[model samples]
Target chain A: MRKFIWTLVIVAVVAVFGGRAWYLHKQAEQNKDAIKIGVVVPLSGFDENMTDRIVTTLKTATEELTKKKPYKIQYLFEDGKYTVKDSISAFNKLKASNPSAYIVLGDLPAFGLRPLINETKMPTIVLVSGDSGLPAQSPYLFRMSLSSKDMIQRLASFTYNTKHISDAAIMKIKNNYGDDGSQFFKKYFADLGGKVIAEETFNVMDMDVRAQVEKVLATNPNMILVWGFGPGYTTTFNQLSELGYKGEIITDFGVFDKAVWENIHNKGDGIYFTTIDSQANKMNPQFLQNYTAKFGDKPDVVASFAYAAVEALLKTIENPKGIEAGLYELQNFETAIGKINYDKEGEPHAQIVIKQMQPDGTAKIVKE
Target chain B: MTYVLHQLIMISIYLILVYATNLVTGLGGLMTMAQAAFYGMGAYVYALVALNMPVGFVASCGISLLVAGLVAWILSKVVLRFRGETFVLATLAFQMIVFTILDNWEGVTGGSYGLSEIPRPSLFGWEVSTVPEYVLLSVIVAALITGVFWVMLNSPFGLSVRAVRDNERAAESLRISPQKQLSRAFVISSVLASLAGCLFASYVTYIDPTSFSLTESIFILCILLVGGSGNIIGPFLGVLFMILFPEGLRFLGLPDESAANLREIVYGTILIVLMYYRPNGFKGIYSVK
Candidate 1:
């Protein structure tokens, strides 16, 4: 009788724990109307600053959305750490950890997540540098940021059409992002009847770009086209200013961070960069006010893109047009980042705007 | 289900890595830091050849092994000249140089943007595409590697290497060439590292320079050190503890923003406690006399 009682006690204890686990798991499941958004971002590592802004803006967007939607919307964020392995690990973990309606990838490269996303078949909005072949690989994948090619063409057009600076030169970091921008700008500018006099490339961590700067200025081009990010970009500017080359400098929108630009603004005074238009700020005044009040400053382009991705994802989830079809039908959706439209390739069709940095570290839109 | 499989695959890959690391750092008593470099070389070589040619999995692995072995041999010449901390510093230089080559050699390695669309490993034309299939392949490969490692640890060559690790002069007195033994050990370690890298590249279908930074080398070393060196099982357990313990933190209900930091703290505390209470590690075989 004692042995039987002990066995019964063990079984009962196991049943209680198992039953509670099952109940918790069931509670986590959606009850016919809840939406889960899985956000993969670099919450740690080199890209943390950018993701910090994105997470704040994304939360604001989600909160604003919950009020307007009938369903209870929730977000589950995962840290990708800005590496391919970590990104995929985070994606897999997110899927297993929760039930997500869709995924939003912030500031991570698109190619690394392409295979995994194809496998998952989850509707994903990637807010990062775009790749032409990414969407085709995974039909459920959509991009919220402008492609490097698109931005380069816009920069080239503005410089040639408005500024009328014909002779141009190129110096870029020898990486994919830089290579894309440099190649496109060279071809487009050359096709527009401008001569690319000098083209030089540097490694990602090359601090002293004096040699490349000298080669670029040797051609005495009417303008210089540069490409890079972070300290490398700033280092190039420092070398150019020190070399006393006063030609109009052109680069991509990545150099638009006010904090980074503040110190190097005067070095490249006539510097111009191209990015997706800031009409989102114009259209969503309330969002801007709230974001500014919370963060004590305005959100950057990356943050705006992240916010747009969340808003678009939530809208799709609430109305439920199916995964691929719903994202496809999400055309001309107005968000904090202006009117958003995606081409058949899932590439954003947002207009590009060129802005000139002032001495005070503020950027003004170039009308032309 | 797939998530668990993914973690298992990752564990298998690191098992090979930590095994190779144990050969050099645990058994050989060398503190080289070029494991990530060799791993990257293997990944880049495999990805490039497979993408540009009609090579299958075996051929790609062979070529990657050859390239990694050659690099390891050349580095060993310089590394064998140093002792103690100097050896580590020299290998650190090698790691940085290899990383620079991978990052700047844009035409071949694809530079910072990384190489993607690497074909899945196919054996006799059977594609390993699904998570379950990949997991099985990884398990088989890991088992084969472990079997080889076991043979090596019990062999005459393994004994000689361990002798050199224990005492260079005494090993020489016993007619063992420390230079030759250390060199062989390093070359073998590099070969294993390359194999792991090839598997990772094929499995992930992407290769980038960021994955092979100095930080990664330190991480591999931490696995061996914390798991207790000088034994095969120690490294295996170390890899599992290092990989899975942190992963289990995901279920702790911590806020997302603080979870990553807290996980790090928890792992750091574990390491500290282990170092204090059981320096030889749970399944460790060697201890300071």
Candidate 2:
């Protein structure tokens, strides 16, 4: 009797799981007109809001692009679950979907799937990113995102050239991004004749970094390049108070999440960041208006690029011909983000922006 | 040649782990989920020592054994209560505790970025830098460990453990303390696990927390159970199946996006089928005693 009950339970569990998987497989086969572009993003994970904007912008841009074009660009969004394995799984699913090109839209964990991406022989593009440092390179991979190497060099140059900040301390998430960014900043900051007193790391999810901040405080840096992400950044200032380490907290565009500013501490004035998009840019008023009307909010760096991606794709396929025409036309198309100059590699060289936060939690571009 | 060598080294590592686990869960009436914690310790120790200290072959082996023994002693003391489900839960707590140390303790362990570019291991004026040489060393060590397990299991000490496992109350009445027997089995098992971990770390030339998780503990146990635990040749056969499943996944060659996940589904399905059809295992003694 016990054996029979156990057997029945196992069979029922298998039946349900098997049913769901089969339905998904069948759905893919039915969508014949759709050209599924696999989009691995962090929609429900730590970078949820950012990915939400990016995915939405991409969808909207695709619709707009399709209306202006002969063929429709269909995207299949896959949440990476904020993990390397899931990213690989998403890549595998895209390959299994028999898509034209599986896109590594955002999320640095996408590097973990580089080997599988390379094996697919399909073109893959990355947006503005910090490195996770898993795979060094792949033929199929093309990243227009400012590489860690480039970002650090530019940061060092900017820091040394400026007379405002003399001494800089470093605090980063204790991952590949932090490791590379820290090392890069350390080497270049010193090479550029800048003094870096201390380099420390905090767990990206750690709400309290008072211990590490105390040591960095003891160094008495004039400013701190406090590299962090997600909710961790909001807690950073709190940890600063506990440690009594008050200095300028400098960060990058990646940490400019909506959740960061929604909190009180993150809303503080004079918090400087180097990002790409300007929410109040008079030049791209149409973009700002349209994005706000649709998304009900201002788009961040990822949303702008993701929005640009769909815009680029639609404009590429403007004519009724084929992929060749789309490819050729995209070479000349302009996006609100910047010019879309896609090589055979599909890399778009876009301009990045630097913005500073106001006391009211709004970031205005620090005009050079 | 390198590929062949890699497989041999992999086989050796699995061999030691399987035997170690088999001794605990197979011969003794106790289950453990903290094997991966011990494995992680060995890897981290080797990574730190290789980077910082003068570590020779003997030194590496000694350190691995010492770390395992210490972890086992501490764990056994804490988890000796509640033998069935609670015991499983306790070891799970141990696994989580170890993971916390690895993930949160970044300053010392390098956290999630992992310790990379580990120095190649050398022994007695002979360095096994290449794949084939490492394979030879791994296989020789594996064979010796297996031989020791083989002898130990056949000894009177092994008989007492099995007696206690089969009937704990009866064995206790006969003067064999269940606690002491289980603890001894656990320590020996941990040593074997840690030794394999040391070799794995040295071979990969890196150590990370991701490599050792509670999932890994389940995987090692699956090998022994799927091959029919408690009897001779069970753990060995189980190890073969475990490696073969992944290699089979490689052959499917699904698309980039679906290949990895589909392979995982397939792997899980195989385990499920095996458990259903052959609960005693793929190669258990069929005597209806």
Candidate 3:
């Protein structure tokens, strides 16, 4: 009798957990006609406000697509909390909720997720930019955000081909994004016949860039490349001006915000940044206007990236071949961020525009 | 399901960490926060050894054990000189120093980008690659560590450690060397933490500075305190509550925008209530003063 009771208890335990799993799987199956997109972002942490805008854009994109398309679309957003562990946890929960998602949208560094992505074979679109090494590690992973390597390469090419700078110096943050960018810039710039005279690094939370700036200034290079994000990106440029260096300064789209320039008293004249053409508010005027009216602020780069990722995912699902048809199949696809294409490795093949901040604190497109 | 197996693997790792922390903080009466540092040290040591050396995963684990144990011994010798708050401060300082080294030491530790492409653990030509296989390995490792800890707890050394915890002066009066007992406990706990780290690195196949940050140490401490760790089973209970509480919030039907914060608030509230009502924990033998 005791043995029979033990067997019953074991069976009951399995039935409870197994029933929950079956219910979840059944719910997922009911929405077979809908294309499910799982989004993971820092919704309640350091980048919460910025992520709110992205979420808003995601909602608007989905709503607009649902109104136009015959099939319904579903989205599940989870908080990554700006950490790799939390991101993985969020991804797991999202995956459990929908076992057969078309694609997952994530906005964290992709170092920790590569192994899992390789194992699961789930096509994920990464928003955070850096040295993902995705092409070599996991082919199913697609980087929707602009690549830091590509940004540096474009900056290097522009410096060599257009500015005719033979010598350069780089100031980067002492993290993966900066390290990868610095390495890529040096190699690409050197291969393009330019010499990097000096390279220095600063921590992300560091307020003091004077020592690094001074070290780079001592090199007396014709051009300077700065790799950083947030307000600190402008700090390198300000410190350079304070030291009276007159070299052309280059950075990524992280410094494209006019608010960043306004924060600095010096205005850091002659500093340029690489950005997508969508920042000009030339494409998708209706969507931009709607976003501005809704949020009282224009949709920034974060929103643009979110919109483009959703657009790409929607298009890929419509292909009937899914993401496996290869992101390259969406050749010259017109996205919210203008004409965009992808190479065989899922990297966007698009135009990178350079914008320079004028002495008056206004930025104008310099190179397209 | 793979999801359940994944959660189980994570729980096993946390269980090991919580058990190690309990050995020192719960029984040895030391408020040390350097477990995360030892854990990261073991992971980095394993990753570097496995990748650079021609040694297999077992050899890498052995090297990690030796490296982490030695470092823990050296750290205990230096920090155990102080008692109470000063000792806690020393551990905090050591934690910060370790974190800084891990973040800045790009040459060996891979800096903040983290070490990736870590090969999966293989046991005697059997590759533990699949989720179920890794889960089984995790359970076995956790069980082995627990078994070793259980044996030690039933021995005279465990009684000495607890005696030192109850009253160091009394233990000394009873001819027990308080310093020796404390140091032994600290070293044992730190080595076990390193073992847990090796399992973590092998299972996750990647790690970063953030994983071994001060936040993680505090989280492990929460597992001990909230679980009311004074006995062997206390750490298991603590690990279960801490791991499952936050995860349980996923089913609350909360919006994504508020889910993370709400989960923290709920988890914190439950812990506070538990500490107030049941300070000795559910199955703990002693209450934290």
lDDT against the true structure, each candidate: 0.79, 0.69, 0.78
- Tell me the lDDT of model 3 at A39: 76
Clashes in predicted model 3: 0
Question: Chain A alone, model 3, TM-score?
Answer: 0.82
Quote each prediction's TM-score: 0.87, 0.63, 0.86
Looking at candidate 1 chain B, the ten consecutive residues that score lowest on lDDT are B250-259
**Highest-TM-score candidate:** 1
Candidate 2 lDDT over residue span A1-368, tens digit each: 99999999999977866776677678656666776677776545466566656666666656654554544566776645555434654555556567665556443445555545654566555665666343245555555455565566666666667535657998887666777788888888888788888888887678777878888888898778867576666677567755665567667765456666666343356766776553335224555667789766777667766666555554434446543335434654566566656555434445655677786666787664
Please give the TM-score that candidate 1 achieves against the real structure: 0.87
Interface RMSD of each: 3.7, 9.0, 4.5
Model 1, span B35-107: residue lDDT tens:
9998888898999989998879999999999998988888898898888898899999999999989987877
Instruction: Point to the candidate with the largest lDDT.
Output: 1
Which sequence of candidate numbers ranks them by TM-score, best first? 1, 3, 2
TM-score of chain A of each: 0.84, 0.80, 0.82
Worst 10 residues of 2 chain A by lDDT: A278-287
Per-residue CA lDDT of candidate 3, range A123-191, in tens? 777774556465445677776677777788889999999889889999997777888789899999999
* lDDT tens digits by residue: candidate 1, A12-115: 96786677667657766754356667778777655566676777777776676566666776667777766778788778887875555445553344567778
Query: Clashing pairs in model 3?
Result: none
DockQ of each: 0.40, 0.12, 0.28
